[model samples]
Target: MPAARGGRWGRLPERRARQLQRQMQAKEERIAELETENAVLHLRLAQRLRLAGTAGTRWREGLPQRTRSLLRLQQAAQRLRQDLRELRAASADLLGSCRDQQQDSLSRILAAVQSAQHHGALPSWRARALRLEQSLQELSARFHRERQRRRRLHNRLVELQGNIRVHCRIRPAMPAAAEPPDPVSHSSSASGDVAHAVDDETVLVRCSRPGHHAVHKTFHFERVYGPAEGQAAVFADVCPLLTSLLDGYNVCIMAYGQTGSGKTHTMLGPRPPGAAQADTGLIPRAAEELFRLLSEDPSERPRVEVSVVEVYNNDIFDLLAEDGCAERPGLRREVLTTREGRKAVSPLTCLPVGSAGELMELVGAGLRLRARRATSVHADSSRSHLVVTVTLTAAASRDGTPEPRSSPSPPQAPSCPSPSPPATGRRPRAPRRASSGSPGAPPESPARPAGQVRARLQLVDLAGSECAAASGARGPALREASFINRSLAALADVLGALAARRDHVPYRNSKLTHLLQDALGGDAKLLVIVCVSPHRQHVAETLQSLGFGARARQVERQGGRGRPAPRGPR
Candidate 1:
């Protein structure tokens, strides 16, 4: 009896559903019938209207009958319309119930599926996801390793090529403003162009004599820039050295040439007013690049500081200094040697820079204070050798050590063969870099203090080497000229000693060479941009400049011999 009762109870809901379904079907059928009747009535009314229009008086005879017929049709339509509304309401209710039932069934299905997944399939899926995550982590680690390897290899390639790179730039002829000053007469035509860039690596100087045969001298360097090449072309060769600087290496880029030979133009771009934005020089571009690189690794917030100094009259003046002397605003500073043997200038002002704009503004301010004098060689000659040093210190990690992200261990410099014993006075050794265990292995370095991963980008615009007679000067200007010539000669002597691999390099022969001892004799990467005029009148000075650059290319820093410039066609 209990079984029978259970069966009846279960059948009750099925019976009710069947009854509701039957009622819904009946309502739909009734609504369809009403719609059909309404359509018939509409057609009949149209036909009657057409008859009325065709036979106006004739149609009036049966007007009463037609009116009665129309009333009956209207009443029928009204009743059918009421029935349609009722059926529609009933049908809507039935549809809502059906939807509720479907929704309940779907909920039950979903619950069952979820239960199955939670118990049986979830663990397997979770394990597979974990494996994928592990694989991704491994891939990321491998990628980092490969990236570090590539950096090492690239730096190695650069070192093998040459640490001291010499590039020759033949200044193109420009208007009178940019030309060398002629004290003789204003009637002379522009100086004839004698120096020509034969190719990317060769420069040919045509020295034509009045009566004797014309002589052509070919000079080679790591790179050569033609007059057609823009500033971008020159910076392209230099851009890579910035990477080296960031990777924990000291870099120096110096422009050496005669006055009015475009050294200042190349290093700092053209001075304001007339200069286009596109002609921006190396210093600003380098600052922008440094900030760009720092932006990429936002986690490592590095600090950059800039110090501007000018070597004037054999004295180093801190252009950024705040001395109260209106006559000589730049405060004089002296170079000191640390216990580590590195050359440093104490009490020198170092302004911290946040962005490229800030760096440029600071540099611009310092440039305004830099000493300049008008001479026969250039209208606005840089009387002093300007050195703008940008120092970047790596951010510290939580443990107070150098951050690994921004401060990777720099590759070890190539082992230089020490040919002879040290001289009585040896210059301080260059700051040591992290030594790599092997070529392919990651660099292994001792734990260094925070900010120890510091590198310097020294942009030097050397005072042009000039002949005292050619660059006419009276009292103080003549004295300045004498000092400039002496210092440049001292620089030449240092390079000659380095090229000859002599035990004693005369870095102390002049303050100019003393300040640049690390770049010239140590492991720092050095790039000399030898700027020369294309004019025939400056042939002697151009040759002298080229000879100095040639000597610079032969002096290798540290372990390896200097890479010779690629010889071009005669």
Candidate 2:
């Protein structure tokens, strides 16, 4: 069995080898089939991958171009956004400017509409009315433009007709009980009613002596006011001058009369309790009118200053001074002549005033300090000359803003000397600050800088001229009378000199005349209101005053212009 096992084992080994070979072959065929199937699967996978890649490539075709296009679109969109931002910015700017223009245009249209409504044209639907309203609106605008020119022309006309205008006023006859009996003239009538206003322009003085024939004298003046004439009537003629004042002209209105002739009444109006608005005097009335005009256009916001001075016993006193609440003899000032020949007062108290009432209060305060004394001719008489000067300063700005107040400095000379005359319709500009050390040039005032316009309104109430004997003067009264007479004589001399066209006018002869040198020299519009009592006792003074008025009428002066305001942007 062992031998058989060995042989069988060896044969089995061969058999095993052959069996292994067949098994190896079968496994190879199986491996080859598996490899083919695996190769087919690989081919299929490669095809699928190629197809997927091709489809993906086809789907992704023009990706760079599309990306570039998208980038371009984004850039274009960004540019559009930028352009839109720029357009918005531009529109904002345009709108801002247009709004400003529209605001101005709307204001003008509203004014026109209001004017149309005022004339009852707004309610009318008729074509004719509409056309008329349109024409009226146009005319109104034209009139507004021409108004300033008209003012210039009117002022020129006033200058041509004599810059100095004279008016005469007759006071009513005083009660016999009030008049002192004339001891020297016993033959004279008890009631000395002699002066009378014959008409609106004529004054007649009728005097009859016992043995002499009746003597009648008539004087012609610009206007004559009877005692019956109200203050309104007298102011009607003087009202036009206020307009000239606003046109940058210096104006002076003075009252001249004998004692007790009603000058105070006419100038200051009825005293206190008896005084009504209708009976107010020229000073208050003028103040009212001035403020009224300024109120019409508050944008201008013109500045007004007031200074009051009194000439008492040939001495000038600054009534507006700090200690000048009452008649303080120490509150004296010196009148100075500028290099430009204009009069100025140093250390003058010039207070700023806003309204007419405020200005009047100032005036009233000054008047309280004015010199007054009782005389035989009247119970209360003005013993001094009162001068109230109102200065109007108009400042302009390049940027249309209010000017800031500057530090205080010495005031400059107020005279303007232009190289050439202004155009026909244009107003002259305000005086400019002069160069240092130049002729007639003073140091510029901090309050008033360059390119500022100034105008002055001087109101004067002169003390009465009376005979010493008639006034029953003694002691100080006699001295006052003498000085008064001398000043009156000097005034007459100055007027005569002006009338005769004398090259040398004695303006320094008296303090009164010297103080009013500018007004008398024809640089200003001067209005003289001559007041007289309608009584034979005062006939001599009346005649003298009338003669003075006549002389003043003959005095012609060339009017000087103040600086014209600058025109603002329309």
Candidate 3:
């Protein structure tokens, strides 16, 4: 029995030892599997997921086994439980770390993709912007080329027409509700008045008459303006004339109409601040455009001079007369003639102008000094004719000779009138007031030089034709009206003679005609802007005005037959 007990105890020790070995082997295998998974996760997730070092190299190698005498199988089972808990904790931590790293890697990859997309699109946007700029440049070039071609055609037409252009503008009629009763309206009935613009260049007038069938008359012209048009639109038609003046041709622009017409308004515009820049008149706008053209070529700084004159009561007065000028401004006959026989009336005030603002100042002063009167026909009637002359002289050539200019061409068969399209305009920019210098600055530019091609531009504002009876004139007013009528009649005679191919144009018949002799007889370009009233009361005067315009048009037709044409190359 003792022998049997000893053998059983020995076998029990062996069994326990084998059991311990089996448990150690299982723990080792589990640790190895966890380590391998951690390694793979670290590589896949890169730096984001990292596993902690094993508890110690000894634990990884193998734990020492306990003897049956020191440690029982139950104690071994408890140790195994502790090791299992520790391994599970480590594995849980590793899994949490790997999940966080994976999330971070996904975010980084998304950001990289977005950055690549943005960089790739940069060149496409830049190329589109470049194309827009190139297109704008090309359009600008094409516009300028087309404008040059148009200018050439305009010059040809102007020369072929004998440098004379006739344009008629009809004043708008006041609504019957707003218009006062016509003091001079004849033929009983005050209604049934019609004024129609038959075409762009034709105006038809019809009115009721007690003893006759409805009177009808038609007037034809080169250009016409309806009431809806504004100052800017009218100026566009005159824009090409400026280019001609710049090429060294004398230009005359005259407004003719009865009293209360819009001649003053057309020539000078409404009083300054009350009007918008786009509403300003032709003279001011011309000055602005002229300066802009000059600025284009800074190398040739040209000089500009201006003079203002008024013809009142058959007498000439220099609105800008100097301190040592003629004895009496209104009666002065002082005249100046250059060696080349270019005639200009002297004793008139002449001002050196560098900018449009300065020119306007002089003009305002002249307006104040001009003779005016209030008549029954108009609240503020112009009693005198005003002529504002602007002279431009180009810079001399480097060879001390005048630059070649386009000389006027001889009168030929009338060129087919080109129908001018109605102009579209925008708000004009306000111009900077140009002065000589600082408040008291030095000369803005050099003095006028010789050997330069000089050209003249005249803006003539004629007083409205007055009805002695309707205006209720007496005393000096009546005398003034008579003088105005006589002078206008003489002007008509001059036009008729020119149209008839007479030897003399009778330019000396009146002071107004005498002063316009050079413009009428020479190769100077002339533009007559006939202003007509649409009021029923002014029917007779309107007819007379239309007759005058027709004669002027005839003069234009024959190239001002009495006037001589230019010779030699321009």
lDDT, each prediction: 0.75, 0.75, 0.68
TM-score of 2: 0.65
lDDT (C-alpha) at residue 224 in model 3: 80
- TM-score, one value per model: 0.66, 0.65, 0.61
Which candidate should be chosen as best, given TM-score against the real structure?
1
Off by over 4 Å in 1: 1-136, 176-191, 211-214, 324-328, 395-451, 559-570
How many residue pairs of model 1 clash at the backbone?
2
Give lDDT: candidate 1, residue 414: 31
Q: Which residue runs does candidate 3 get wrong by more than 4 Å?
A: 1-154, 160-162, 175-180, 183-193, 211-213, 271-273, 323-331, 395-450, 556-570
Candidate 2's displacement at residue 339, Å, is 4.9
Report the lDDT tens digits of candidate 2 across residue range 1-570: 999988888897898899999999999999999999999999999999999999889769978888999999999999999999999999999999999999999999999888878866745647777899999999967876887678768777776655799999988766667777755355334356788888989999888766556769989999999988988987887777887777767789999988887787778798662556788888898999899987876556666778888877777766655541222233566677665456876556676677898898878878776766678877777788889988876665777543432333344333322233221211122222222111112111333465566678899988899988788888767777777778888998999999999989999899989888888985688899999988776777988999999999998775464332233311
In candidate 2, stretches whose alpha carbon ends up further than 4 angstroms from where it belongs are 1-144, 183-191, 211-214, 272-274, 324-328, 399-447, 559-570
TM-score pick, better of 1 and 2: 1
lDDT of 3 by residue, 1-570 (tens): 999999999899899999999999999999999999999987877644333234355445555543443468778889999999999999999999999999999999889878868677757768988999999889967865875566567667676654777777777665665454664453332353455567778989898756546668888888888766788877887777777776556778888888866788787887543588777888888888877886775545556777777777776665554323222233244344545565567433445677888887777767776777767777677777888888765545666534543232232221222233211111111222332312110111222244445678888888778789888878777777787788888888988988898886787678888777767666678888887777776778888888898988877433333332221112
| Rank order (by TM-score, best first) | 1, 2, 3
